[model samples]
Target chain A: MMKWIMGGLISVSVIVGIITGNISEVSNAAIDSGTKAAQLSLALLGTMGLWGGLMRIAEKSGLTNVISKLFRPVAKFLFKGISPDSEAFRAISMNITANLLGLGNAATPLGIDAMKKLEKADNPGETASRNMIMLAVLNTASIQILPTTVAALRLAYGSQTPLDILPAVLLTSLCSVCVGITLVFVFDKKGGRT
Target chain B: MRFSDYIIPVFIAGILIYGLIKKVDIFDEFTVGAKENLIAAFDILPALIALMTCVGMLNASGAADMLCSAVSPFLEKIGFPAECAPLAFLRPISGSGALAVYEQIISENGPDSFAGRVASVLLGASETTFYTIAVYFGAVKAKKTRHALPCSLAADLTAFILSALFVRVFFA
Candidate 1:
């Protein structure tokens, strides 16, 4: 599946470039993007290290356990089959909390940790579980309480009140998350292979 | 200073204090966790490179622009900013590319303009779905991600539409 997606993307780009007479630009982009990817991964390494460190402290101090307990109702609703006392639950709660705080760096590692836990507890093959799909969808339609990055960009562009769009951001994110969860429920039936 | 500025510092300090009270060997635990996460990051590097290369090629080939223009008319009818068509198309595929386009929009239209506000809300309301899916799925070696892609894109579509609507209601 990953191979097909990657191949499709590459083939489309090349085909389009041929017609558009931008093959040279496409070649350059292919090379540059690889470099960019390496740079991005390097940047993520530092962030992952820092956040992973802090999260470890949180976990050892039972902070994540407390967070998991607080989030049990919501987690149980989203992840029906997963046990609330599991590691996956704790990691998922931590990921959601980090995302809400607009902590992208923290969220990524926690999300990966959650995915690993989910894979371990249930999924034993290459195919994703229903809960795994839900987790990915939830992350994609992330509901952020603070639009910090957008606000910073607005400020850089000289807006008087950068965070003025907060309400709108919140509304849109809510709409997306609701739609995402609804679709997942509709499409991925319970106790069935998805 | 914005209120958000205090969040990270305060949160980090709180974690450190909590760790101390719990008598956790903070540095030892930190390095252990850090090492694990760093390995995870490394594991996903190949996927990231492949996805980004494809995205970069699409952008360079003008395919993204073509699609944006093709969709702009329909978007305008739906009250979506036509200028943000490219952003709506690119946002899911590439985060930094979307940022570059977004910076251009805000600079060209001025951050206070309707398009700028819509773009800001749109950017704030969603994640880079493809990038995130790759990273998370890649970490766990999940090859067959059934329904995740469609579900996420549906969410992105909802976000793109509501971003414009809410921006109008709130600011316009």
Candidate 2:
């Protein structure tokens, strides 16, 4: 499988890195990677817990119905074969909202929930429907505004001024969103008929 | 405690408790889900290590230095700082790799230097492109993310240009 090839390549590289006088490099990489992963995990747990809880409360209070109503237009454009009132719609919106704030780690569960709902709707277990694929594409290209994890890392590293990249972050994310959405629509149309 | 302190735990507890009361098997389901994620993360470690090491080699070989040198003049002409170019190159490759470059700039030029400030901002705002693409796309098993790569790079390019412009007009 292609997965094995990719995995093999990486393993070889790490071995090569070790064989070189790059032990320190490996150690440094490990430390940095571990710290980042830990921080992200904690942040994800906290944020998802909060948001998921709020979503549950909203569901109980009938607030999700109102929120779904508000999200209908955007949902219609981004996702198809799903009604505005569907569970998938709410999950997709929540996922997008979290991603917009750059809480990607927090968005994963919502994305999974949305996909599950979509799968349930698919019923007969045909190949992934067009909407499912489009949803995946959109989620992958989800435009980020704040880049919070990056900001936190910068601060941790002792940057005197951390928020300087805001304009750049905003502009880049806008372009990505536009391009990503356009490609999804084009590809969905092409893929749908085939 | 502040409202935020109680928010997350209460939410988690409430969900699990509700699931238990409803006989939903939520605990077992969540545990299985977590286990799957752990396996997935482990599976991807090798690719992550390889990509990281290649980036490390690139840094060690001074290829990035040459690239930065080659681009500096053009960057300078555009009113962007020369030092920020290297960080831009490294940003997509490795998050810490870029940060290390940014640190060097701050140390050499002083923390409040124009280049240092810009680097700090860029560091805060950009993603480690390879890591993100690998982990996220790998999760869903979407083999052909044709649009994902170009679109994200385009975004990174936009971020680079806008950061430069903002620093030039406002900070510089």
Candidate 3:
């Protein structure tokens, strides 16, 4: 789905640019952006590496597991059919904890771990189950506590008070997750599951 | 503020202290964990390049601008700024694309402006919906995503609306 959209958008953009006489700029952007992606990934390396290491320490010290336990009740309520003693439950609990802290880059590895566990537990084949969809919806809605990236960008751009928008961040994320969870249940009840 | 900036560093420092109390080898574990990140980054490189290329092309072609203008009136009618429609549209599809647009908005409107703050909040609150779906499902080799894409996209829309409304109420 994303592949088709990417290809279609690129093809359409090029044709549109040619017709609009923006062909030169389009070609230049293509070249420049190819380099930009690598640079962006490299930039991500430092932050992700630092946080990844910190999270590992946290994980080994059982900090995240404790946080997981704090969220366990919520997880149990959300993940209705999953057992309390299962690894999948713990993994997903940890994943949700990482996401709530606004440690998105640090959360992916954990999120993937949970996805694989959930896949093994509830989905034996190559299709996403309703539970997996619910998890994805919640993760992607983000519900971040810190809004770190936005603050970082604001500081880089010379905002005197980068965190002033924190209130809005909290409100918006809470609303998004509520709406997303509600819709997921509606869809799940419809057996929109694969 | 600097106070907000300290939160992450402080959290990391606390973790380091805890690791010390727990008698864990911080350096070795850090390297092991960072190595995992590096390997994952390398694997994701190709996908990142392809997605970003399309983002660049779309920006250069003026197509994004056209699309924004097309939706701007409807957005304005609903109380969202016309200027922010692009940010809302691109955010769910591509993180880099949305970031580029977001930085531009902040630069143009001043970081304190309603548009700028709303864009900033939206950036922080929402995830790259399609990209996350693709990566998560791909990792588990989930060929049939069923309701995942639609539900996630719906969530993205909800986030955009809530961000715009909240920023208007709180910042404006």
Candidate 4:
């Protein structure tokens, strides 16, 4: 879906550039953006590599287990009826923690694991359960203590204070999470009719 | 050497120490995991390259400028920067797209400028809504999304509105 949209959009833009006699500018942009993407990938490489490795250590050391215990009460409300000691609960907890710390790439595996575990816990129905819906909403609007990726871009762009947007990020994400959870509860009750 | 500068290093140290306490081979494990991470980066390189190329074409084609002018009157009335219109549209669809646009905004306006600050805040606040929905739901094989899409979009909307207001109050 996304690939098609992006491809069509790009084609349209290129055609527009040709019509407007900006083909050279467009060609330059293609080259320039390729370089920027390469640079962005390099920036992501270090941070993502370091965090990925550290998270492996954290996982191996049973840190998430300890944190999972701490996450129990919160998980009860956020994902109620999900047995606290279950695999789904553990995966969900770890996923949420990864998101909170702003390790989104790290969160992906855990989230998919959690979703699979959740699908297993439920009956053999294809429809999404309440827990699945809630997890989707949570992941979609998950709070971030660090906006690492955005900050990386800011730093690459020569921002004097890369983390200066932290407070506003927090404020906006807080609003998003709150609104997201509220809507989830309101809609999930009627079997997502609203 | 601000407080935030210490966070990443501190986090890495904490994990390594904890791994040592757990009797794990920290160096070997880090190398193992980092190698896998590098492979992962390469895996996404194609998509990243394609998306960025599109971002460049769109930007250079004057489409962004056209959209900016199209909304300039309403934007001026609301005291919002017209340059952010493209960002507001692309953010939910693609993370790299918005990031590329943001880098452009800051490069032109300077990072500390009002538009740049708002772009930073807005970028941080939201997720790639369409991408997230498609990925997670696809993972679970949930054919019927059942309000999840609309609800997540509402959240994105909330983030958008708040980002503008919060940026003004905090950065201004």
Candidate 5:
């Protein structure tokens, strides 16, 4: 699937660029992509380290256990087979907590940790497990309680009430999360034995 | 002031105080965790470059714009502004690109305009599905993503469709 998507994108881009006489720009972007990607990684490193460090402290202090315990019911419902007391569930709960707080930088490192745990337990194979897919879906449809960056952008643009759209954003995100989880469940039922 | 400003500080403080009370070697644990995470970051670089290259090519070649234009008519039928079509298309594909489209919409239409409000909500609600999927799955060396991509795209579709509706219902 990744191969097909990548191939199709590259080929379609080349074809379109040629037709539109934008081939030079396309080649330039492709060539510069590595530098842009490395720059992004560098930017991400500091936050990842800070959050990763803090999360490690949380884990060692048993703070994650408390959090996982608090979210046990939700985890039980969403994660199915995973034990609420397990490392994977703990990491998953922490990731969800960070996401809810709109701590996106914190969320990624925690999420990566959770994925590693899930991979260790449910999937030793190359294909992703059902739980893994669900986790990814949940991250994508994350329910952020405060969209600070969007509000800030609105403020910068001189809106009278920058956060006026907060309710709409929250509602939209909630609906999408519900739909996303439901779709994952549907896929799980259809696929069977993952 | 945005309430979000205090979240990180408060969270960090809470974690530190808790760790100290629990007798955890906080600094040692922190460095170990940071080291592991930094190493994990390297695993994601290849995927990042590949996905960014694809997105960059699409952006530079104007293929994204063409796709957005093709779909704008259908979007107008649903009362979603045609100007935001590019945003909805780019939102799942690239974060920075989506932000650029969103800023363009607000600057062009004014922040309080209907289109601007919808774009704001749209941007706030959705994630960069492709980027998140690539990085998270990439870190684990997961080859076949199975239903993850389709499910995420479906959620993005739901978010895009609801952004306009919710904005209308709440703000109109």
Candidate 6:
């Protein structure tokens, strides 16, 4: 259902673009946009590989357990129903950690993996779980610390003080996350028993 | 020296060098990935181009100027700096175009100027609405995204108001 709707929107946009004689402009934009997406994808893949490898090493070294312990409280709050020791909880924490650090490119696979784990944990006949919905919402509104991509773009384009927006970024992201989490709780209350 | 200056270039160079040294088949992988991205971009190009061209047409046709005039009284009442009106219009439609507006403000008014700082923060902190809507919905196979449209637009509005208030209080 959702898929069809999104496809329709994309189709309409493409049709409109063609009708407006914007195909040429689109072709031009495509060159830059394509290059950007490829470079970003490669970078993300590389970082995820590196992080996954390190996580394995950390597990061997006993650090994964320690990190998991550290994140237990946050996991408890964000993933309300999941047991602290659950695989889904751990993955959710790691995914959120990556997102908080503004490593969303690196966080994508972790998020998908976490969702799969959550789905597997759900009762066989149950609908989508509350934790799953909350995780999706939180991920979409993930509070960023660095805003690295935008900052990089600013620097690339010759801004003399790219990092100057750091304080503002932090403040706004904090507010956004707070508001988003609050709304999630509000929705949960209004929607019914979790 | 600020740490930001060295980090970006180093990061890019490190990626390129790593690919070359590891015999990662960087060219083949990069080109393959690039090709896939090109296809995706082309798929969405029509919408993106229409939006941008319409925006361009708006600017050329002077409708944007007139719109700005119509909104000026409300804008002034809200204490949003004059330069930001163009950006307020551009931000939701396009990322690069908004950045161009930001750049213009910074160049003309100086980077540390209140309007420039606000614009910069707004650009960094905010999401590009149409792109995000398209990408996330497309990825999730969500067709209607009934809630998503309103939710994201709300978020944008919150960011805009908060950004303006924050800048006026601190930078101004």
Per-model i-RMS: 6.3, 8.4, 3.9, 2.3, 6.7, 8.9
Docking class for model 5 is: acceptable
Candidate 5 per-residue lDDT, tens place, B3-122, comes to: 545655677899899999999999999997777667766667777777678767876898877887788888878889877887887788767656555655786688899999999998
Worst 10 residues of 1 chain B by lDDT: B95-104
For residues A1-194, could you state the per-residue lDDT of candidate 5 as single tens digits? Answer: 56775798889999999999999999998898768767666655665566668778877888866765677687678886788779998889988877775657678999999999999989758998888888899899858866655766677678888777877998999999999889889988898867
TM-score of chain B only, all predictions?
Answer: 0.63, 0.61, 0.70, 0.82, 0.62, 0.62
For all candidates, state DockQ relative to the true structure: 0.51, 0.12, 0.55, 0.62, 0.47, 0.12
Candidate 6 per-residue lDDT over residues B1-172, each given as its tens digit: 8665675466446555655554555545555544443443344444443333334333333434566688878877877766667776667666545644554555556656677777767776665566544543344322443344444555566666677777766554
- C-alpha lDDT score of every prediction, in listed order: 0.81, 0.56, 0.78, 0.79, 0.81, 0.56
**Tens-digit lDDT string for candidate 2 (A91-170):** 78876665654444556677667766776775425345555555555554436655444444345446554455555555
User: Model 3: how many Å of interface RMSD?
Assistant: 3.9
Candidate 4 residues B9-38, lDDT tens each? 787788899999999888888887777777
Give the alpha carbon lDDT tens digit for every residue of B62-127 in model 3: 886788788887887767776677788778877766766675577668878888888888888889
- Among the numbered candidates, top DockQ falls to 4
- lDDT by residue (tens digit), candidate 4, A17-122: 8888888899899888888778878877876677667767777788766766776787788886678879999899888887876667678888988988988886
The RMSD of every model to the true structure, in order and in angstroms, is 6.1, 8.4, 3.9, 2.7, 6.4, 8.3
Report the lDDT of model 6 for residue A171.
77
- In candidate 3, what are the lDDT values of residues A52-150, reduced to their tens digit? 677778778887778878998898878868898999888898789888765566678788888999998886487778778878888888777777567
Better of 4 and 6 by TM-score: 4
Error of 3 at B81 (Å): 3.5
What's each prediction's TM-score?
0.69, 0.55, 0.79, 0.88, 0.68, 0.60
Error of 5 at B110 (Å): 1.6
